[model samples]
Target chain A: MSKVKKNVWWLVFSLLFLLVLTVAISDQYYLLVSFLFLIGTMVPLYSRFEKKKIQSREIVFLAVLGAIAAASRVLFFAIPSVQPMTFVVIVSGMVLGSEGGFMIGATGALVSNMFLGQGPWTPWQMFSWSMIGLIAGLLKDSALLKNMRSRLLFGFVMGFLFGWVINLWSVIAYIHPLSWLAFIQAYIASFYFDLAHALSNVFFLWLFSSSWIKVMRRFQKKYGLLD
Target chain B: MHTVLNDVHPITSFCYYIGVMILSMMFLHPVFLIGELFLFILYNICQHNGAKMKQMFKGAWFFIGVIVIVNPLLNHQGTHHLFYIGRNPITLEAIIYGGLLALSFCCLMFIFLSYNLVITSHKFLYLFSRISPQLALLTMITMRFVPLFIRRLTTIKAIQKTRGIQMDSGNIKTRARNGMHLVQILLVCSLEEALQTADSMEARGYGVKKRSSYLRYHMEKRDIFSLILGAIILGICIYGKLKGFGDLQIYPSLGSFGLKGIEDVMLLILTLLFTGYPLILEGREWLWWRWQK
Candidate 1:
């Protein structure tokens, strides 16, 4: 087979291996193992295949960003304000591109939850934050999202969207006595946190918009990425 | 932290989760809820992780507020009048009932928090590595890609804005249209990434042979003991629930029975212990570390 086909088969096989690994562990272990493998193996694979050049400095920066994202979640519990982590994840995406952004978001949840404790929600948290990173990466190269207002808006929408999507998971995984109504109630109850998160995103965007642009420009120039 | 307790066996933890879930759904015991809350608080204090406890409370405040506001308005059935608000009559029973509901929620949260402490993603994957590779792979990829997708969307939005497209200060319809445009971009990018991943995995021969894990979780005697203890607690709780120990009664006369005296308290404590085991273990570990130091 050609090199491309061989690569495709390898990718398919690895994914299958991941599935087997997930089943081997019990539920609690399943989430922990899956997350580690994703960060440890799948991420590097993507980086290698894409031939992405990540400097040591970039890795450190992403790790620190992950730490801050995790810290912000802990802070969210105390302040009862907007979600600073969502904005942080978005910013990480803006600066680091898709894979870096993803690692930051996923790792942030993984590490932070260690402190706060875990549950079924950990996977959901990982999924939600990762989605935020993915969205940011996709928009990194768009023509229309380069302005300050648009970035701020994107951040705001993400805040709300993040809440909505996670609530969808809660509706499915959490067995509420009220059934369907429980989902609605959970969504409604979560509105304030979502609003706080959305507002925080707006603030962060306003506070750091220019610096972000400069950083993105420097990253693109330095690495010739997402061109 | 004797690693034995700090690190609960995955099977034991999973069983505990199922037990708590079953209790929440069927039993609806006020004692169980209250006991769970007390244990969670005690465990939090013991861990000295004030920061995490604070975060859990803070993150949950909005939801608590919403429940406080909506429960009375929607529930509407109760006796023993408390007061009158507008045209609505607030009852003593509804308030007490709402409090119970909130407690129940906190119990669930505590269970989840404990689970998080004991279980890591790596262990989760290890347990399931041999069962079904396809599902495991899909799950792993999904977890891996979600954040990547979100990150890409953010950058794409920024790039679009730089090209002179304004997304803010628009009508709802306009904002939504812009949002859809971003989503479309993400969908396309993700598809490409998925294909690339597929190619990479195929080349590596990922599923061509049996896979071996880098990290191994050995099930020792403690693991068996923990599992047995978890089973006993779960069995008791199930037996109690089946015997109608804590069933809620709501009808012509609003009252509940089945949870009374020592058995009630014991059941409550057990439920809380099961839910908060991780936190308790973490707390014990911290204490032991402090002593050793």
Candidate 2:
């Protein structure tokens, strides 16, 4: 009981820390604040996985699924910003729980950037993709995400959100004395790529998400994974 | 791998890269950032003999060009009006701000290129494994699987090409659908095999005790020295930035570009040391080799 209380306090503290970091992004220390925000949110999630008594099957499954997501990014490189990584992460969240979903999204970003190139954008990409998975998993049992229509809608909105959040690294760090005009201009500049990403996400989720979820659910049941 | 920077502990090198990256963002003046850009580019050349540097430039120039070209057009808040493209007034201060943005980004790009070269995957995983062994193990397995999955993807694509689903032979929509189909197949097959791999790991008693690293990197004397030097230089840089030395205020009005004080000169020297840390280390090694010859 005391341990549970301790864990609750930790959770509250981290959430408050994340809120503070998010507010602090508008301060002069843009890069540092965003980096702290990513670390603050990600470390708690990752540490929870560490503290748990996870099965080998769970770890291997998450790794293989994340690799699949990363490889598909490389495979679909011919298309510009039209990868199915978001679809895979969302589907994984629906099948597995939030923890499982967060692992896949985080590893997907880290590993794909391994093959692509690592830059200042890596942490932002990791944060954005992981949030997609976390939110999807959190809302998995909800009636809003119960049907196919809303799920695809979630994917579409997440696509734009991913682009917008990723663009923050540049807009926050590089844009001087940030104003709404410059901020809107940066978003406007990325509109074409973001639209393509959103459309591709919808397309993949609409056509293949059901089967993918079924396949993952079957594996989870067979292996008694992430239970 | 045997170079001076890579020879130091990964934590030292990691701290070095982080220091430079934060400095790049902090120093928002054109002259300071451009100096950083040149130092990092020279460091890249020293790191990889100009091959990776070329690739870095190829990938970076587009975004750099975009920002430099776009900032002036969008930001019309500055007072020194250069001219009017249509009714929009582009200012000299805005142009300088754009160039500063581009230079900082270019510095970041070069810094990352050197980072990847210096801190290889084994060291990266090792560093993180100390923090959280589970996440590090997961990352290792995922990194190992990426190349294997890419290879399996090729095989699956070839096999599927014998069937009706071919990415190249389709229209845009069809091609994307076919590509996703290929990925779905890869997913189903790999998820099954991954369970077997997991069983194999359990059979081998994977989590019976604390995880031990195969590639061990303990901090040595050189690492300590480098870390201390890095902290000192970083301290001076941040101290100087807090005093409003390295960064230029260019939003409401442009700050003077000339170094107007002794503290400014000191800050410039410290900034040089901060950016050129790795280059100096590697250059001294080269000179030592020549002296021995």
Candidate 3:
């Protein structure tokens, strides 16, 4: 409990610091600020995982979900920007809770990139997917994510959010002067890809997430995994 | 795969790629970037043949094109205006900035391509394992499960198709539904088995003590030598960066393209050598092989 409190305090402090940092920094430093932002946000989650005494069962369970998510990515490789990875991650989160969900999401990104080829985008991909899982798990019991329709809505939003986060790298790296016009233009250029991703997430969640969640929940209960 | 960096220690190569990546981002100068890009492209050509390089270009040209074309249109901050579509002036500085950034990104992409070829999955895992043993173990398990799940998915797809649950032969929504259903079945079946694998692992005493790696990587004499050279080169580059020697100032006004002093020339040469670290090793190996014969 104290550890959780400490983490929350750290989070609040970092959020405040980041807000100030972004407002204070110059435009040319956008790339450096964004990187620092990524590292700052990611460190806490990974450190929490490191501090815990993880079990073999939990490790294997997360690995299996990650592998399944990555396999779906590879299977749907022919389709551009359309995969059920987010759907799988959402279901994993809904079943396994936030920590498990974050691991699976991150692991899924890492493993999939192994088969697909790693690039500068790998870290961004990991960050986006992991956030999706973390948010889903956090909201699993909330009224916002209770029903299938609302869950689908969440997935849809997350899909675009994921694309936008990935687009941040390019915008930061390439956009000169870093004006709002340039930022908006970059986002606008990638609009179609984000739309496709969002629609696919909605489709997968609407048609299949409930069943995936049910199966996962059953496994969790039967094996007492992640308890 | 007898690639150039194939035998180099993962630590050495990883540091080299990371150093070059950081330096490329910092050195916005055209001379620095063009020389760096040229060396990496040459290294990439050495790593793969002409046909593969063409395929890489095909994959990368879209992003490069977008950056080159979009920057000048949106950014009107520079002094020298090239032209204007309407109200927005296409300044020479924005165009030059865009081109340099595109070149930098293209170089990084080629470097990553070489990274993919050389580091491979196991080496990456090995590097991570040193930092966090548990995370490394989890990644290894995840890596192991990927191919297994892929095979299982293929089998499940075959069985599902036999039962008329075809994923590829339907409309978009229907196909997507069928696909998720297949994955759901996979999840249900695999979860139980994965737990059993966990149980077997427990039986074999997995979490008892420190886990050992299956494949060992050594930091050999050459790797050490390379590390020493890398440290010196990158130290100089970083020092040069702090002194604002390699970077060009483009905003407000354009900076001159010529070297300011002897320090600038030396820094430029060091930056190129640092970026060409992989090629240096490859060339040495090529010469050694030929000379021995």
Tell me, by DockQ, which candidate is best.
3
DockQ of 3: 0.85
- In model 1, the runs with Cα more than 4 Å from the true position are A1-84, A91-103, A115-127, A140-143, A163-196, A206-227, B1-4, B7-26, B35-69, B78-84, B91-93, B109-217, B228-246, B251-253, B259-293
Tens digits of per-residue lDDT for model 1 on A1-227?
49856885776688677778766754423324444544554454434523544332333345445655665566455556454677768876776676667766777776666556665566667777877886787677785357778887898888888787667644433222234566677778788988877887787677654554465455446534444
Name the better of 1 and 2 by lDDT.
Answer: 2
lDDT of 2 at A209: 89
User: Which segments of candidate 3 are over 4 A away from where they belong?
Assistant: A18-26
Q: DockQ scores for all the models shown?
A: 0.06, 0.71, 0.85
* lDDT of residue B61 for candidate 1: 73
Candidate 3, B1-293: lDDT as tens digits? 36768787889888988888888887878888889888877887787645766888898899899899988887788899888888888898888889989988988887787788888898898888877777878888888888888888889999999899978787877887787788888888898899998999999998898766576777799989989988998898888888878767788877787777888789889888888887888888889999999
In the range B7-88, model 1's lDDT, one tens digit per residue, is 5566666665667665664455566666666766665455454576678889787656655555565555667667778878
lDDT for position B219 in model 2: 78
- Per-prediction TM-score: 0.53, 0.91, 0.96
* CAPRI grade of model 2: medium
After superposition, the stretches of candidate 2 with alpha carbons farther than 4 Å from their true spots are A1-27, B49-52, B73-79, B84-89, B249-255
Measured with C-alpha atoms, the lDDT of residue A79 in candidate 3 is: 86
TM-score per model (chain B)? 0.71, 0.89, 0.93
Pick by DockQ: 1 or 3, better one: 3
